[model samples]
Target: MEKLRIVFMGTPDFAVGILDTIYNSQFEIAAVITAPDKPAGRGQKVSVSAVKTYALEKNLPILQPTNLKNEEFLAELASYNANLQIVVAFRMLPEVVWKMPKLGTFNLHASLLPNYRGAAPINWAIINGETETGVTTFFIDDKIDTGAMILNKKIAIDSNENVGQLHDKLMHLGSETVIETLELIEKGNVTTTIQTENSELKTAYKLNKDNCKIDWTKSGIEIYNQIRGLCPYPAAWTYIKDGENEWNVKIYDSKYIEEAHTYSIGTIISGKKEMKIAVANGFIQIESLQFPGKNKMQIHELLNGTQISSEAFVK
Candidate 1:
């Protein structure tokens, strides 16, 4: 087999592990393609992407093209002379770039193909109360996530697992799968499978406030899934309001109990150390949360710092 000269494309922390795997593999990494550095925070300090940071640490050649279709950028990317490209948590690629490599480009997605095929797969899978999810590697094509699949590996989702935990699991899984896919390509024994379509397919669409907001009117189990699905990032939120004031609260860790209850949904049943929100058919015991204009804290900490009136309720 000829040597595999690979160019890796990714940006976020999720992609860092896969990049490291390829770097330490038998294949040669010709260059890295990551998002450009941007200014952030109150002080406006420039922040580099996690992938770029790792690439700098390893002294790998890095490319941050502002415009993927720019003539000069495309010319420089072609100069790398890589045979294969691996994309992780990166932006959508133009056909001109994805088709640059001789062996073609493949992407590692966070969820099983044809399902959860969008930006926030990890979050959506758990939010939708799925019992199983996995990672997939497929050859890049024109449409999003519609390419011929190369390999897939499945894993069960724990009952109480949050998005953060699931993301770590898939990241590790993707690293392994990418390595195996490279080997399959090298041996020239790989068989690509076209994805099947159905009317009931689930899509992991982009998240927004409309989807992240907690609806206490729903069953506790449904709310519970929604809470954990979005936990630790773009958290599930509700408004806690008393007779005097209302505050936006982001709920992180929580547990729910299903039982008969007369209390109206969205009621805030709380004591000094404990806090629970009444949902349809049950209550969600909040373990950790964040208040407007404050850092995250345990339910007890928030209770002690800011008292909740007896009439407090959620909106």
Candidate 2:
């Protein structure tokens, strides 16, 4: 079989895994297209995208075009004469770019097609308390994540799995799926299946600041899942009022305790060893948390080092 010339487009760590697999596989990578480096963190130092960093280390040719539709960029992309393009965790592409490759551009999505098709698939799956989620390799079309599927591999979502854990799971699974899809394409035996015909397609819409706020009025399971979904990054937060001062607390990890509770919703409950907050139905014992200006730390450690009066309440 002739080695397919691939142009890989991606930006995040999830994309890096797929790129690494392709790099080590039998396929030929003509070039890598990734987001441009931008300032990040408190120092505001320029930071290269995860995919770009890996590509640079491997000495792969890299393209960082601010606009995918730019004539010059498109012309430069066409110069590579790639047989196909692979997209993972990258911004939406225009028809001009997706249609440029002869074998067509394929995207490696984190969730099963027609569901969680927006931006934060891993987070959304956890938030919705899904029992299973998977990755899909599909053709890139005019619509976002609405393309015909080339391949899909389902994986179970553990009841206690957080976004961080689920992300790693899908990252590895997606890498292998992308490699397999490419192999099938090279053999001229690939088949494309349309997404489900049902109209109730779940969307993984982009997460924003507003949605990250914890609503104590929700059920214990809902609050628990939301906290876990946003943990470690874009953490789910709630405001705590202490007299005249208000503090924003980011919940990093928690567990749902089935024990009965007398406190009303949004009340802070504490024990000798644990700190929990009463939700609508049950209590969520916070294992890890962070203050507005502090780094994430265990509740025990935070309590030992800093004094949190029991009288203080978390709004």
Candidate 3:
């Protein structure tokens, strides 16, 4: 077998560890392709992608292609002479780019394939109250995450785990999986299982403001899952109202009490030091949260700054 030359593609912190592990391995990283830098925050300063930052520290060749199908970009990419391309936390690839490599393009996805096949897999897995979700490596196909599976490793989702915590676990696990996958591909010992489509399968749709809003009508368990699943990023939100005054609140951490409750859903129960929201058959005790124009703080701190009225409710 010939030596493998790899082109790694990814953005964000999730992909950084995998790239680092790959770099330390015996295989060659011919180049890295990440998203183009753009202005971010109030400063409008150009922001470098995490992958690019790592690549620069290692002095690995980098490509920031705004258009994957652009002729100039393709020519530059082809110059790398990489036989295999590894994608992690990257955008969908064009066939022209993915098909360029002879050993083929394989991706490290955050969820077990054929299940949470979309952008926000880790978030949806927990939000749907799934107790088990795992990482999978597969050869990229024409569709998203519908590729033939090369390898997978399952891990249990703790009852209290948030998406941020789950993400770290999967990332570390994915690093191990990626190295194993590289060895298999390099040694020509790879095998794959075709993914089957099932209508019953739950899809991981992209998170948006509309979908992230807290729907108090659901069971307390569901609302709890939703809050934890989106914690620390694109958080699950609701409006806390005291009479006509309303504040948009983002819930980060919460615990559920399953005792029977006669109060209407979305009703706020608050004392000087704590806050809980009424839901079907229970109350959700908020642990940490944030309001618009404010940083995340504990529920007690939220109460300390502003006293919620007895008539206050969340909707």
Candidate 4:
């Protein structure tokens, strides 16, 4: 129960909240391990990870290793002499690193373990039309997302909740869980539960460009879920062809019309302030979308400037 020295590993904004919460806690943070700076944006300027920025501001030691198994990096990481290591939104760690900490490394995952176990869990849960999702903290093991569970906290997924909304919710929920986990570890009261392997478990594989493309042949509800699941990041995109003009349009927000429609799927029905695409069940009413080289905007705003005819078909 003595003051525990901890090391944190993460890279994205999702990890930032948890790191900030832990940094403000009573435990001593030995060092932070994050991804190396990479070039980004139009100028291709080097950009630091969110964790690194926050760690620098808090004056915490940082180590960004290009190779996790490198001897020099491993030696430096071992020098921290941390009792526990916490990971959130980070790459898979080698056994040498996760096994080094006395209390072992625990990862903050976006979904409840034993289900939706993979990258992009939040997106897959919604895409599969699940009404519930949760966050879990588990000990790091050799297999991805396959580890003994420490604790989990469930949260309801609204019928129409998008991935972006669910992501922020889980991020904050995970912060609280991480703090509770640290307390459990310090008190020596942690009991790990083996993750039950189910053959029917739905693995959340990382989304790709091809997978995010809207499939108009599906029902309106299915299309609606797909749009929301991929919203605000790697959005659901489709080709819009207007005679000689064919361009890609990414859908960010939409609604489903359950009423039956006779029109063939992918038919674009446009109006002054509203646009809908025909599907097997009915239509997917476009609410917010982005054109190539343009910022996301409402259907009306897009219609006001673009000459998208009702006759134009969506592919």
Tens digit of lDDT per residue, candidate 2, span 186-220? 99889999988577878898999889998888888
Candidate 3 C-alpha lDDT tens digits along 156-271: 99999999999999999999999999989988999999998878998999999999999899988999999999997889999888988999888899999998868888888999
**For model 4, where is the 10-residue window of minimal lDDT?**
214-223
Flag regions of model 3 displaced more than 4 Å.
none
Better of 1 and 4 by TM-score: 1
**Which residue pairs does candidate 2 place in steric collision?**
none
Q: What shift in Å separates residue 119 of candidate 3 from its native position after superposition?
A: 0.2
Instruction: State the RMSD for candidate 2.
Output: 1.2
Which stretches of model 1 miss by more than 4 angstroms? none
Minimal lDDT window, size 10, model 1: 302-311
User: lDDT (0-100) at residue 176 of candidate 3?
Assistant: 98
C-alpha lDDT of candidate 2 relative to the true structure: 0.90
* RMSD (CA, angstroms), candidate 3: 1.0
